[model samples]
Target: MAEGGYIDFHVHLPWREHDPREAARRLLAEMDSAGVERAVVIAVEPSLKLFKERVNAETIRKAAADALDYLVYMRIPRLRRILFSPEESLNEHERILVEHTRRSEDVLEAAEASGGRLLAVASYNPELGPIGTLERIKGKRYLGVKLYPTLHFCTPNEKRLRPLLDYMESEGLILIVHTGCDPGIWELPDLCSGARPSSLEPVARRHRDLVIVVAHLGSYSALKPGIYFDEALRLIERYDNVYADTSAVDSFLVELAVERVGYDKLLFGSDYPYVTGLTIADFVESILRMNIEWRAKMAILRWNAERLLKRLGRL
Candidate 1:
């Protein structure tokens, strides 16, 4: 955990009434302590506002601010960067009761003003519009399409989302989905309860060419107390395009997941704001203490993501 190399693909940013730079600096210090080399900073499109109203306590974390935090504290042997998706990018087609439009240009301008250390994910909810809306995005800033089935009022299996998924598949874009056999809450479960990773079978069958990345490795679920592990793993088995991350995950589960999935199929992520170095390092230590080979263990920590990114030309 001291001095080594690791790339964190899934990390979050804190946007709760603090200087974005300061928040990122604190996070960077923590990442340094954990031996994380580079990080893929991800910001979601503020799609949440459509579904959930603000309680006086919690503020929305914009995709741009998350990217800003990463840049603010970016300096080290650190490949500090972020993946940001404005919440409103996907809602352009629909006529909401409220007109909440966080345009891609606006998100980009805010991010550029923050200096550097930012990249983005272009989000298109084909549910909102099909050919025109999605076609508007040339996708210069984004690595791929980020789909929030829950926030946009569509499940992954919905016929409406299929066109967008199909576009991504045909275009070879990386499609990141929120999965795990989930409940029915727009903020909670974007995909349907029946739309588990296994539920993605339809999409997988139709779009075998797409690189479907499942967020948090399908960690958040209803597997009883300890029975859900196999259910999560079932996703990886079900889809070849499926990939999982270590974001927002606890230590024991991370180690167990590495054991089950092996290092090749896994990636590192903090689900930041919600994720922390202490949370990830503790898991790394637990896994390293086992009799596993150092290479496999280290691959889970760092090498795996590197290979994937290289394949995507991010490296």
Candidate 2:
């Protein structure tokens, strides 16, 4: 790895056992090719099983329609998995929790196998409550917690989650919440509504010491209006603990993010595997092309993330 090497703040590790090790191998290979020194690898958080149980057919139908719109716009094949096989569920919350545990274990193993090139982040559904989830990860070697409000159908400021946020702050666990819009098998509007960046404001204010990262820079709606891109920017501007990542968004949004959020708070992230058609190399190259100084670009690509990991005691 180079001195000031690139660190991917976001990347997904597969839950499917069919060939997850091989998939991770491919991911590491891509990272090596792209000159990514290290990556914070996380497990997929969406539970199709939970969605199947909690959502009604009308909502699923709406989600299907939204999936169609997304498919047409993005022209990606991965989105079809949720639409064609909507019945396939991961089971109930218990099953989902079990799967998440297994996925976290797999990620830890992958991190170990990487010989320190990968850092594992634990993913939990806040719906099950934080105490039980914390018990599962007790004494585990992970740097952060991954939250998917859109997939879990909850908000960060939910009364029940205050303890969880407090615990994260106490434990020095970085909270990487999935913000902005999410599509595929889940109801689009509801998921988007739950994950809006503003929803995190209260929690960010309360847990001012916790490191909060709003993934995708809250521009999940692309260049369209009605999303929380501006809200995300405001949070970062208002709170020193709040930060944003450039994951699964276009270069235009990246330009906007750097100009507004500044380089110190921006981190490089690749929503790999889910962010189809782009390799880690492509993602890194996009940042290289952005109209920013080399030092700022390096900060976004590595220094900022490395600094955060050090603070979290992961580095």
Candidate 3:
């Protein structure tokens, strides 16, 4: 790894607002400004096929309102426990719908154009046939697959996802799973349960060969801070292949993770566009300022992720 250069394990192409090619260029500029040598740009697909038939103008309107409320409460932590409450969980007839989908092709195209400054991670919605999804990303240049169990309304250990996990492990690809709560309609209790880090324990136990990076350190939600922080730490401590990322988590949790599992098990991730008001440099600075050894800071900021990418032959 280059001196003073760190890898951002989690970042996203601005598929919602800008063209992926343009978004890639903008991300590179930001990285250059932040001293980020490389980043893993994740593609996301929050849209669900089961809810497609039920989606209409009214549902979309309600979804937008839910998203706005979530954003507001995120900015004001006090409002989370007081004002924010969904009347009902997402059911068959009523559910949140996101029209936009970030395709893996767009992410790959952008990564290909980044001159090795970026690595692509494809997104998978298990509801959309897992085997077919596997076939789609089989020969692609993706470093791994990112799974949003809470957003997709599924669990990591779902039977449908077995084939995909099996294939990734066999091919030496990594698995980045969303192990914390999500905002908007996903904040509901039912959806939140899906993202619990405990649900991933079985998957980790079964697929010991597959490298798993638990995103958000299993405690990213403003509404419920550190909800599954302990569970995430336990996995990292118990499984050699299981690790956690410091994306969208509080600084104290990072300290706690180090105390409990040490620096080698932690990776630095900025969550990028979703981090809001913070640059990749800001995250790097936070780690640098931590009350730990200089070597630990370097491991978290760059070396840890550099080792993973190297194993995958991406470096």
Clashes of 2: 1
lDDT string, candidate 3, 214-287, tens digits: 99999977667787899999999899989889999888889888887899979999988776688888888888
Q: Order the candidates by TM-score, highest first — what do you get? A: 3, 2, 1
Query: lDDT scores for all predictions?
Result: 0.52, 0.74, 0.79
Q: How good is model 2 by TM-score?
A: 0.83
Ranking by lDDT: 3, 2, 1
**Over the stretch 186-218, how does candidate 2's per-residue lDDT look in tens digits?**
325544677888989998888989999999877
Most lDDT-accurate candidate: 3
Q: 8-71, model 1: which lDDT tens digit per residue? A: 6655444442444554555465566667666554444534454444211122233224335433
lDDT of 1 at 247: 57
Query: What TM-score quantifies how close candidate 3 is to the native fold?
Result: 0.85
**Candidate 1 lDDT (Cα, 0 to 1):** 0.52
Q: What C-alpha root-mean-square deviation, in Å, does candidate 1 show against the real structure?
A: 12.0
User: Candidate 1's error at 208, in angstroms?
Assistant: 2.1
Q: Of the candidates numbered 1 and 3, which has the greater TM-score value?
A: 3
Clashes of each: 13, 1, 0
Q: State the weakest 10-residue window (summed lDDT) of model 2.
A: 87-96
